[model samples]
Target chain A: MHIPSWLLTFCEYLEQTASLVVLLPLGLAFWRWPRLPKTMRLMTVYLVFTELVLLASSLVELYRPAWSYGIWHFFTLVQTLLFFRIYYLTLSSPAVRLLIQFAAVGFTVFAFLDSLYLEGLQQVNSYTHVAQSALLIGLALLYFEQLLNELHITRLEQDPLFLVSTAVVLYFSGTVLLYVFVNKLSAPADYASHQVIYTLNSMVNLVQYLLFALAFWYAGRTLPSQSRP
Target chain B: MNSWLLPVMLATPVLLLLALGIVGFVLRYQRRLLRQQEQLRQVRDASQQQALEAALLAQEDERRRIAADLHDGVGTTLAIAKLHLSTLGQPNLTEEATALLDQAIGEVRRISRNLLPAALQKFGLPFALDALARTVPADGPTHVIIEQRGQPRRLDPKRELIVFRVVQELLGNGLRHAHAETIEVSVDFGPDYLSLQYRDNGVGFDPAAGDLPPAPGTRSGLGLTNLRSRVAVLHGTLRHDSAPGAGSKVWISFPIPYLPADQKPALTTSV
Candidate 1:
């Protein structure tokens, strides 16, 4: 793949901008408000970790070749782990904590095998991507059930749970559509399809970040103010 | 993984997910705050109603105490005075002197009975109501009847007192204001409900009129409003049905639980 100099600069700029825009606020939230809900804390940590991975990926491509593959594998493993956690919290009943433990062990074993066997790296990556996407879609469906009779406007007026649930649905749907159509339409001869897929993916990313911020704000200010120790 | 492609893809989704999570948290927090506010409002309303009822009950207790003191202490002293005066007078004493002592005794007795009816404390509601029925003038065109349909049960003293007082106040108002000749008091005891109905044959007034009577002694310039307040606290419904020259009927229905301890009277026996 022949990369233009301008496109490289743009990618680097995007990397720095995303780190500042998303990670900084999340970092501050975790530091100042240590008493945030477990769900929210998990999400914030996930955000900061992802941002650092992306930064490392960009830094590896720009300045460090020998270490790039190792960093990618490490971040990919982290991404899979975080996705599982999000799915577990959003989908499973609180009483079913045991299932999450089983999932963690399963994913850890899979990640170790994928890292050790470099010959099957692409296959492992593709498998993890599909599994992660399936889990998110499943989670989104579970939350949609939580909001079965719930009207979006009614929730916007009264309930923050409804708002969070709706956001999750939108973000999950966006990712599903983007990924399913990404390779099929974006062949080398057809640059237009590739650009469209990337644009749609970026838009989905933008909406999801905004929604996450809203969820955090609601959690911090509107939730029951039992003086968190 | 293309070094550039992997990070770009990962970065975009992560940022978007964070945004969605943030929004969810804010909305949830707002809902919680609103719920707490509504709960606080309900608590305040309930406390206010309770406070008003408490103050009214205290006032009634004070009035009952004062009425008792006058009847017992003052009536005793006056009787003793009458006895002494009679002893001091011999056969030689003038007719006017004896008549004066007798008149003084009658006045004292009337004052004591009016202050607190003896029937109320001794015989319960039915007997007291019969006494009230007798007080109405016989010459009036309207006839008054007091009837009990089912076996009567002894209510808790607190509940019985309120029912009796309300009935008294309602009847008194009818006599003074309704100009009705015939008044009927009927008590019906069903499986779950106890109903008291007072119907008069006078020119009825509009219910929407601002001058409608309040609680029981309120119309009598003493305790009607307080009586109504007490009934409301007992979770009973008091309703008024009236129109011009149509007569007035007041119905009070209460769900007083039937306990084994409640004494059931044999039947409707006249006072």
Candidate 2:
């Protein structure tokens, strides 16, 4: 795919502008105060992973014809997979953890195989995106339900856990909407038609990054008070 | 420019801003409330201490007035009566009459001593406490035991008096209301704290469900508020634990910031 120059410029803007302007402060917070809240820690980890994806996509944008879309697609796939992994680890159920690990490994293998040969099959790619979106929503829902149901969690509304979880819901809902609907209904056949989608996607990334910062702030503040053994 | 995408795109900013506004308001409100609560607590503690001091001073003045009246007026009258009685040898005075007159003198002396223990001024708090403890009857259903632990350091006279009165009130309450089978009173001295614990195996009241109003006449009723005030002056905390069908326990701990280094073991000075 000979990607359009305008689309390339937009991706580069997101890659550089969002990384420095959005993710940098969050990174600083993570560095300066390593003892972030649980929510913040999880959000930072998620953002760092997403930032890596964006950085990879940026590189792909600059390289143009030499690098295939498959590379960027694979980046998204791996990031989403890692996100789900983070979700499962946080819940900390031994049985669920084992189950997610097994499922993820199998899914990664399948995604890699699909990336190698399924470029001609756009529908397969779409279906894969749908699956990732579903997983994100499900993980978000599970995290929310756990936070709400915990009886020992006094001052739940003020809790960093609740804040970070709310952020996660926002990011998940926004991302799912973009992935599952925007491309199908709005993007034209040409790469130029996808510019708006790219811009919207960057805006979503910006929102996600900010929420991640909040999560970090909350986690750092609360961790010492609870003082888990 | 699809109608659907337009509405979603425009609403996002407003929703995000609204959420931020709500968060800021809640945080500010909580902080303000916390500050107000702390201020209120300090004010309440200050007023309570002032009232306790005024009450103690008034009580001391009343005690002194009673002691003076007994010594100057009553004591002189009794002495005159004794002198006149000794002169009754001039008449037909029987042995029974002489014995009765001698008993009256003994009773007068006992009353005068009970009214004011001269040892309280000379011996200080530990001696006074021991004297009071010795007077506690051992024949009741509740066997009261007193244990003084660690080195006893001398406290200010006013503090000692307050402690004495508080302990007396506690003993009275236990005997009258608690119907306790056994009562153990302990004074524990620590490096920076002096603690008193009164434990009784008695029919306790539910702190949550029981009457929240202060019990009148009992130490817990009238004297506890005063006791708390005295403890507060010394930066202390008092806790009471009781439950229906269970026993009652009172724990009071206050700072002892000025204990002398060479204090002796005050615990062994018991009846």
lDDT of each: 0.60, 0.61
**lDDT minimum window of 10 residues, candidate 2 chain B:** B262-271
lDDT of 2 by residue, B80-163 (tens): 766776777743564556566567656655555555545554565667667767777778677888788887667655566556
How well does candidate 1 match the true structure, expressed as C-alpha RMSD? 16.9
True contacts kept of each: 0.02, 0.00
In the range A1-229, model 2's lDDT, one tens digit per residue, is 2446876686768745655656554665667465764434555666666667667767876886346356556665776776666677677567766767776776676666666675432322554565666666566556555543333343445565555555545554554545555545464454443554556656666666665555545554443222122
Worst 10 residues of 1 chain A by lDDT: A146-155
